[model samples]
Target: MIEIKEITAEETYPLRHEVMYPNHPFEYIKLPKDQEGKHFAVVNNAKNVTVVSLFFENDNAQFRKLATLESEQGKGYASKLLDFIIAYAKTKNAKKLWCNARVNKTNYYKKFGLKETHKTYTEAGIDFIILEMDLI
Candidate 1:
């Protein structure tokens, strides 16, 4: 079963390292899970990974990292996470939502009304464009 829950700061330490190391290393977003950021993990039985989300509230709450485990990719887990975050942001009264969506996945964000706001940029060896969705 896949469950999404908020992770404590301590709980995210290892996961953060795992995500931002080797293949998917991202240092800018690595943060203590409990330090105002929300860490949502989609875990299944027997401790296999499904997905993870790391984001925080701001003038506009951002969907920072919506990551699906390598084994669980292309199964709509990312879509579900996006839907969940959109609904959660609505509850928080966010004015807008934004992400630096990977170029390959630009179409996905477009489906959710996120318009690309910037030209392509490279970060951590990945190509992406900034996309924003208006909450109001």
Candidate 2:
């Protein structure tokens, strides 16, 4: 069985390091605002965090470091986690939820009502585009 729940920033480091910044030093996965952000994990029967995301800000929430384990990809864990964060953000009265999405994942974000903006940036040789969903 899979379950979604709030998690600590410390708990997020492992997956974020493994999936998102595997090529870089593990310390590079630590975001500066981690302590001020809300972290979430999608766990399975083994209690392993299959997916992770971090939300920050008041009126505008940004989704950061959303990653799923390689073995867990295509199993819908990401979709489920995104669904949970959207609802959670709504409850917090967030007018927008956005992210700097990896270019290849733009379509996945669009499935959750996120639209890409003209802005783009590069990180660690990977291209990313800003995508936002108006929650109001």
Candidate 3:
């Protein structure tokens, strides 16, 4: 069995660092505004957090640092977590939901109706593109 629940920002750091920035210093995965965002995690039967994501709300909601353990990939954990986040955003009356998706993962995000925007940038040598889903 698996469960998804709200978690502290610190709880997300492990998976974020392990899966998203393994080669960089652990601090590389720490977001400056982590305290201001809502964090969540997907825990497996054994109570291990296999996936994590962070969200910030303003006029629109933006999710960041979505990561899943390498061993947990292809199992649909991230997809479920994303679906939850989208619904959560709507509950907050957000006009949109967006993310700075890694360029290589845009196709994966597109599966959930997130559209690629013209904005693009490089951070830590990885190319990223803005993807957004209209919520209103």
lDDT-best of 1 and 2: 2
On lDDT, the leading prediction is 2
| Tens digits of per-residue lDDT for model 3, 21-89 | 999999989888888889888889755455555565667889998988887888888999999999998
User: Which model is ahead, 2 or 3, in terms of lDDT?
Assistant: 2
Give the per-residue lDDT of model 2 (tens digit) for 1-136.
7888888888888898898888899899998888888888888986655555556576899989998889888988888899999999898999999999999989989999999999999989999999999999
lDDT of 3: 0.86
Winner on lDDT between 1 and 3 is 3
Taking all chains together, each candidate's TM-score versus the true structure is 0.76, 0.95, 0.94
Worst 10 residues of 3 by lDDT: 47-56
Best by TM-score: 2
User: Considering summed lDDT, which 10 consecutive residues are worst modelled in model 1?
Assistant: 46-55
Clashing pairs in 1: 20-25
Cand. 1 Cα-lDDT: 0.68
Model 1's number of clashes is 1
Candidate 2 — which residues are off by over 4 angstroms?
Answer: none
